[model samples]
Target chain A: MIGYLRDIEKSFPIKDIGKRRQRVLKGISFEIKKGEVLGLVGLNGQGKSTTIKIMLGLLRPDRGDVKIQGHKPGEIDTLRHIAYLPENPWFFDNLNAKEFLYFIANLRQIDKERLKQEVEEMIKRVGLSGNEKKVIRKYSKGMVQRLGLAQAFLGDADFIILDEPLSGLDPEGRKMAKDLIKGHKKKQKTVFFTSHILEDIEQMADRVLIMNRGRIIKEVHRADLYNKTLEQVFIETIEHDRNN
Target chain B: MIEIIKLTLKEAKREKGFYAGLILLFLSLICYFIVESFAMFEPEKVMAVYALSSVEGLSIILLFFLIFSFLSQDLNKKGIEYMLTLPIKRRDYILGRFFGINISVFILAIISTFIYMLLHLLMFGVCPFAFLIQLILLMALVLMLSSLPFLLITASKRPTLIAFLVFFIYVIGINLDDAVRFLSTRHGREIPVVSRALLKISYYIFPNFSFFDVKIPIAYKLSFSTMHIVFALLYGILYTFFILLFSIMLFQNKEIK
Candidate 1:
């Protein structure tokens, strides 16, 4: 690992007697330095969302620290440069796609002319051919994913976090998402995305983070993205966990 | 801050149905006042009572839609996800919502009360300037009261449950005379600290919709002291301010999970 790694500790307390926290993550430790498209891979309940939430400052870690650009996630001023998208997000209904983009752009205080051009380009890039007059409810899962992706790319923030972005997209939509990730990577924007679509990760991730039982099991490299599929590595990793 | 305010206004305005409903209620209030003006037996009393209660009632009804539009609209439409992704503070968003709803309520009331000015012209041929001022003041006072409890509901896990609890408590408080007599053994003598404090706060803080019930007496040329009106308005404002301050504090710690 070229980047620094901190000691992380995660455990479930005796809270919630019957339905305790799904302790899918355990002492996961890794470093994502600048300019990395870290793909997070895990089966269901693998602490993917929780880890992402901790990084986004949504959930505080029980015993660990994530230094993003040398600042903790909860640091509001530091977090201003980060963009996050949950697995399946909900958005305002009345806002047409363009209006919603404009709303976020205004919140981020991006330049008016630049925001106009960028949103238009994003709409076009996602193959969401429109003037943004269409309400978001009209969008399919693929379209909503694209719309959320457009939002993530807004403000041109330094770090972008997307969870399971390609979960419900068609082949074409997946291609678009892949292209979007590639663009973010090209701009040196550090991206941490999680997904069940192993093939998409094989295509775009510069490095992969595989987890099991609330722990960082392995870090796969993109240079080896073609050497063996993510599925192969995942099966091997899960088998290793089972044996040990 | 102004930008946030502007954004809040725009967000609330997008709910076309909500503003439409409030506008309709305001229009109805104006029409009712106009019709009541022609009914002349104890005309002053009728006008004053209608003026106070109808305005208060209509304001609440008009505001209900606005509040629902702000509170339920996001959950209904799932629109807040996009909002939360932004770097904006959550309290800023909540306060923006508060501002947007109150602003709409204020505007609607102003329009409705303005129409009442025409009744004075058609009936007595006077400007009704003084009545208009009182309506404006009443609108401000009620706006403050109506939104005061919003902090409680917003901070709670179940807004509907909290609303029911609030209603139940209010009902009990309004009927406290009977409630305490039945609940206690001897003359309902020594109240608990919590109950006493609650009673004191409710009597002083809540809008005291009954105070304005006296409007009919005042409007009918019955004698009343200016000090009472002054005290009532002050209590309403102070109550609203304290509650809003509490909301801000709670919101500061709120994590919208």
Candidate 2:
């Protein structure tokens, strides 16, 4: 397994001046095998991002075990193999695309000889070639999203965890991201991502996990999704769970 | 860790505060010169005092806010999430930020010291080596307190409250020895025992920033012992070390929500 989360539970303190806690994730468990493309789908505030955070050790789970590459989340060894792109993709606005990618590449410990060439290649690959010198603050939302994808795919990371990876992209940017995922799949890299776009998930994910109310309500494999589009199945499943 | 430091330096370069600080210092020095011109006796002496005070006070305030905003903005803007996810240890990240900011702090200190020296030469016609030593101590003072915001940001979510608390700590800390000395006099007996004890306890708990203030000695040309300088350096280094260790611990366990 490239990743695993067993019986994960998480909650955050209420924002108000109270001691109350609002549970965000309640017993979330899933595993992503090597070379598999797994997608997590849930409505807003359904704890999809929170689950990703727990797996990356950005946030601790109240209960459960999370392991990546047979190591606990956030361990140096585990993080060395994992590349995470957050849902909102906030980056230092002062650095230009090349500088920011170089920063990430340096952290990824890519070889000194190949660092420059690799950063340049990724810049062009993400369709940010002409604008590599422009600071990220000047980039449009779609451009920033593309830059986020560039950094995520840099340095040959083995397991890529992307939260809403395709959220802010335009059609061309979306195509670039889809092609990048396809390229990773061709290399037999494990990719786990979350998206609200069922069409994208249906096309990309080998297995899709449907999360709602902080729990996975359904799991559908590409081989099992017969005679119905993912949208129809998702709506039917949510409605069925609600009625029950 | 090196990458983080490099990133911080790049970010610091784009920050306008560094240039603004230099400009602010220059204007204040000019203002001091004008204000001291009205003094009928030892006008140059008065100018020197005010100029140095301006440098010290402005450097302290500017450095505090610069470092505070640097870290706090990263926290608020979610830039920290990008940082903490890297294949580096949290301790390395914290130390990298600390070191990067201190490098900027060092640059600012060196530039302001030169400015003060030039101002002193123009006003008094004799710039002693003590000015360099005294201002270096001022840098040490600010450096020691710079780690405080790191600790505060990790321990509390209330940025406004933390800002006030940092300022309050600076005020109380710098004036602590004076306050304690004044309290120990005849008027001190009027205060409650518990309150006085708490005050005495706080004197030990908080950083003794009063120890680093050498303005009066520099102003009056009074000699201070080398031992005093040595102890102050030791105190600043040790305090920063311990506080940063504590902050790293808190950060390692913190939930980045």
Candidate 3:
């Protein structure tokens, strides 16, 4: 497995208020195989993002173990092989898109010779070619998302995790994002992505996991997706879990 | 680590506040020259005291604002997630930020010193070597002071709270000696023993910023020893290291939600 979460649990402390703690994830367990596109689907406030964070080491699990490539999450060596795009991607406002890409490239330790070429190629690949010089603060929401995609896909990361990668995209942009994930699939890269749009998951994910109220209530395979509409399955699963 | 440091410096350079602070420092220098040009007694001494103190004070304020704003932007805007997602360690992130701010502040100090030297030469026809040395020492002190805000930022997520905590610490740190002496003296005898003990303990708990203040000596052009400077330099290094270590510890466990 490229990624694994075993009985992961997380809770956030609420300060200066009556509420003491809010539990966000409850003993979630999952695994990601190499070269597989795994889709995590859920409504707002389910543990989808929390699980992604644990895998990316952004938020530590309050209980249980998380590992990437057999190393603990947040280990430098493990992160070297992974790339992440947050739900609401925010870049440094002061940096232009190219500069931001260069920054990420540098962090990825891309060689000086290939850095410029790779950044430019990624910019073009994300449909951000001409606007690379503009500061990120001036970019539109869709443009920022494009830049986020560009950064996440840059370099030779073996694993990619995207949180709501299609949130702010126009129809064309969304198609491009889907195509980009398809390209990653062709490259045999392990990808874990979360999205509200079931169609996106249907088109890209080899397997989908349905999360509701901090638990992975069901897992559906690509073969099953062919038998039933993902929207129906998602609605029924969430409704069934809520009813129980 | 180098990449993070470089990125931080680039960000700092692009920030309007960074340039604004430098401009204000220059304006203060110009104002000092204008004001001291009219002083009746010991104008050079007055200029040295005014210029060095102004530089030190402004540098601290600028650095405080810079650190607070940077951390605030990272937290509120989720820029830190970008860094944390990379192959960088949490300790490297803290150290990179600390060193980046330190370099920027050092550059500002150097610029201020250059202008001060030029102003002094124009007025007194001599570059005050002792004052230059004093400013260098102050730069070391400023570097040490920069770590405190990073430590506080790592400990707390709220920028306003961090600002207030840092300001509170600054005030207490600078007056720590006086506070400690008062608590140990007859004036503090009226207070309860527990309260007095707590006050004394607080003194040791907080950093002694007064050690960095060399204004009086620099103003008088006193023959302060090299040994003291060396000791202060060493102290500053060790103190900054410990503070940064604590910050890394806190940041390593910080959740980016």
Candidate 4:
């Protein structure tokens, strides 16, 4: 397994005078295999993002273990192989797109000689060719997402975790994003991404996990995807879970 | 760590607070020159006092504002998530931000000090070496003082609350000795043993910010020992190191939602 979460549980403390904790994930468990594109699909607050966070080691699980390639998440060695694009990517507004990518590359310890060339290539690859000099604050929502995607792919990471990678893209931008993920697949990289668009999961995912109320209520494989559309399966699964 | 430091310095340079500090320094110099031209009494001394106080006040305010605002924005807006997701360790992030802000503060202090020195030379035809040394020491103290905000932000996420705490601590730290002396002497024999002990503990608890206020000594050309400067330097280094360590501890466990 490239990464796996075993009986992971998480809760957030409500900021009231009296302490109150809201359990967000209730013992969710899953695994990712190498070179596989795993899609996590769910409603707004069904712990999809939380699971991703735990996998990335951004949030510690209250119970159970999370490991990346046998090492704990957020470990230096483990993190080196992983790249993440947050749902709403926040960057240093002072830096331009190219500068921001360079910053991430430098943090990843990329060679100085290759840094410039790699950043430029990623910028062009993400369709941000001419906007490389534009400061992040000036970029539109879609441009920021492109820049985010550009940085996430900068280091040739073995594992890519994207949270709503298609959130702000227009139709053309979405196609570009899909193509980018396909390119990652061609490289045999393990990808775990969350998306609201079922078509994205249908087109890109090797396996899709449908989560509801903090549980993985259903799983759909690529073979099953040939039989039914992801949207149909998703709606039916969620509605079925709700009815029960 | 170096990359983070570089990025942070780049970010700090673009902040309005940094520019505002520089502009304030320029305006203060202009005001000092205007005041010097219309001096009715002890013009040089007045200029010296005005220069040192203005530089100290402006630098401290700018440092506090910049560190607080930057850290708050990073945490609240989730900018930190991008950095934390990298291979860098959490402690490296804290140390990088610490050094980055300190370097910017040092640069600001140097520029202000240069302006002060230039003004002093133009007005008095002589710049005292002792005053220069005192100003450098004060800048070191300011750098140490700026570390508080990083630790504060790590401890609490509320900027308003952190600002209030910072202001309160500054006020208390500078007057700690006076408050301690007053409490100890005013009650002398009448005070309870526990209260006296508490007062004694409070005296040592807050950073003795008065140790860094060499403005009065510099202004009056009073003689001070080299040992005092060395001790103050050591104190600032030790204090900053421990605070940074504690900040790393807090930040390591901080959950990003």
Candidate 5:
């Protein structure tokens, strides 16, 4: 955080949040290190998704910039290191899981032989083994989430951005995702993740960046000092801001 | 680039309804000839026109289905967001889709061309080489026009209305231009050559489906001036490239938030 202050500073935009015309993401920004995971926590309209979009270069901030690996986010070369899971990830439904992965693996321009191996490993890791041959549309929501998680693991990009990766997952699926995220940490990958589930953020994120009304309001990092659940911190932070 | 194309092709194959439309188009070609058998105009002449026009007309109709099928498949199946997240640029994405559809449409054109020729040979006993050439040229023109609406609709946030407006304006432009020309002819003090040339040029530039109408002796067995096919094909391709460049420009600045 000490060396990377400039990263967040550069990423922060200056526009106001709620004016009708100019409001995709107003003045929201932050930075996390290569080995650090930053969990974005906020309510529905606070613009958590929009912030992620900016970081992924999916959306351009009207008044500021977001840099990934010292280059502007969304540039195709820089995006090679970034993996994203949307709020609702979409896949070719008729394609079986394996077929879908094979197709994406090519688009990512991963080597064909190596992609074959990686898809197998990722599916197994995500606990979607033999069902890999089944069409995606028939899968349960939790299974779909698992599929999305496995895809994020593909290409082996350095930075993985996931939005609500655990939202539709059942308890077991969520637990599996937590372990998978920790595994990403062990590999020294920088993870930018978002979720409304505070406890998941607490359990997974090394630090938390809280967004409010399209701006980043606070950063929570004290050695996971309290180790309080993300729910506890989110509530305390939002309520604290209200009272203040 | 190969990845995007491969994905698009796989998607098209997987959608049965797309192939179903292709089948229906084939049937329509045969039915067009059958109806042409009974036209009040010379059977040979009328059928020649319908044969060329029918292929182009079905193409125009089927093209809308292709756009709807592909676009809705992505949006409904959630596959589009996945493509967006990939390392491919949006320009490549758009190009890949257009090329994919182009290949599909070209395949159908080949089949329909074959059917029209076989019938022409059986009935008239001589090939409609000119009709075939004109059909090929017009196929390129109609296809570019078909692609423009989808591009605009997809590029804009409001796809449906924009697509409808795009098709309507083009349709009305062709119809109204000829209607005005007819009115000028009836009044006797006809529109001036300069004005007529201007209108024709606009029609030429504005996706003129009339160029596709091969309704005369030139269309049956004789060949056209080489200039016509070359110029028209060039015009259509250049326009398609322009529309694509425009779409890419719009997409590049769009905030995906």
Candidate 6:
């Protein structure tokens, strides 16, 4: 298993001085196998992002356990093989594309000798070669998303986690992102991404997990999805869960 | 960790505040010069006192905002998510930012010192070595004071709240000793015993910034013992380390959501 989250429960204190709390993730559990493309789908306010954060150790779980590559989440050694691109990705606006990529590459401890060559190649791969000198603040939203993709794919991480990776991209950008994700899969690397676009999830994911109000309502394999559209299944699942 | 430090330094260079601070420091020095030139008895002494104090004060304020905004901006914008996801220990991230911001503040100090030295050389002839020592001490003081924001940013998310809390700490830290001394005096005997005792305890516990104030000594060119200078620098380093440790602890458990 590349990642495991078992019986995870999390809640946040709603008020400053009291124990009043709001539950975000309740008894969530899942696992990602090597080279599997797992897509998480959920409505707004559901615990999809929270679950991802828990798995990444960005947010501590109130109960249960999580491990990434046989190590606890956020472990330095474990992170060496994982790369994450957050939802609505924000980067250091002061840095140009090349400089920002270099920063991430250095942090990833990429071979110093290959760092320059690899960063340049990734920039070109992300179609950001011509605008490498422009500071990120001057880049358009689509450009920033491309830069986000560049950093995520840099360092040759074995597992790539993307939250809303397709949100800001135009048609061409979305197509590029899809191809890049496919590229990761072709290389026998695992990918865990979340998106509201059901068609993209259906096309890209080996399996799709549906979450509703802090619980996973259904898990559908791509083979099982052949008879029905994922959108139809998703609606049926959400409506059934709501009526319960 | 070095990457984070380098990133912060580059970000600091790109910020408009860095250049604005440079301009403000020079403008404030000019104002001090003009005001001190009117002093009939000892203009250079007055100028040195006001100029050094102004630079120290300006640098502290600048450092406070720079350090606070750097972390707080990342927090607010969710930029920290990208950072924490990297194969980095949380402690390394905190330390890297602290060192980076501290270095930038020192750069500002260097520039201020150079200007002070130049102005002194042109107008007053051969700046006193004692004042140079005092400037170094002043840099240490700035380092100590500026570190509070690193701790405060981790503790609270609200910028205004952090600002007010840091301002409160700065005030109490700088004045605690003075407050305790005043309360112990005959004229201050009417103050409540509980308040006096609390102030005294705080004076002993909190980092005493007043001890680092060497403006009067710089003005008079008063000789300081080696032990005194060493103790002040050590105090600054120790306090900064304490604050940084606390920030790392808080940040280790912080939820980026």
TM-score of each: 0.83, 0.95, 0.94, 0.95, 0.86, 0.96
Q: What is the lDDT of residue A65 in candidate 3?
A: 87
RMSD per candidate (Å) reads 4.4, 1.9, 2.2, 2.1, 4.2, 1.7
Q: Which stretches of candidate 1 lie over 4 Å from their true place?
A: A1-25, A224-226, B1-3, B16-23, B26-40, B73-82, B133-150, B153-155, B162-214, B221-234
* Regions of candidate 5 where Cα sits further than 4 Å from its true position: A1-26, A225-227, B29-42, B73-81, B122-125, B150-155, B187-205, B215-223
In terms of docking quality, how is candidate 6 classified? Answer: high
Residue A210 miss distance in model 2 (angstroms): 0.7
Docking class of 3: medium
**Tens digit of lDDT per residue, candidate 1, span A117-225?**
9888888887777647888767777778888888888778888889888877888988888888888889887888988879888778888988887788888897765
Clashing pairs in 4: none
User: All models: lDDT?
Assistant: 0.67, 0.84, 0.84, 0.83, 0.71, 0.84
lDDT of 5 by residue, B1-257 (tens): 66767766766666665677678777876687678757876677778777776677666665666676666655555555566777879788788887777666666666777788788889879876665676677567655765675466454544465557667756854575575566467552476778667666666556655544444545544555777667768877777788888877877766553
> Roughly what TM-score does model 6 have, to 2 decimal places?
0.96
Q: By TM-score, highest first, what's the ranking?
A: 6, 2, 4, 3, 5, 1
Give every prediction's interface RMSD.
2.8, 1.0, 1.2, 1.1, 1.8, 1.1
- Candidate 2 lDDT over A92-115, as tens digits, reads 888899999988898888999999
Best by TM-score: 6
1 or 4: which has the higher TM-score?
Answer: 4
State candidate 5's TM-score: 0.86
Q: On a 0 to 100 scale, what is the lDDT of residue A166 in model 6?
A: 91
- Of the two candidates 1 and 4, the one with more favorable lDDT, higher being better, is 4
Q: In candidate 1, what are the lDDT values of residues B1-257, reduced to their tens digit?
A: 44556665666666675567566666766666676758768664566556555555666665655555555645444344345446766667566666766786666666656665565456556555555545655665555645554676545545455445544544543355545444355544466768766665665444454443345544565666778677757765676677777787776554444
**Per-residue alpha-carbon lDDT of candidate 4 for residues A1-244, written as tens digits (9 for 90 to 100):** 7978889889888763557998899888888998889999999999998898888788899999888988998788989999999988888998888778888888778999999999888888889998888888899999999988988888889999999999999998899888888898899898899999888888899999999999888888989866778898899999999999
TM-score of chain B of each: 0.71, 0.93, 0.91, 0.90, 0.79, 0.92
Backbone clash count for every predicted candidate, in the order shown: 8, 0, 0, 0, 2, 0
lDDT of 4: 0.83
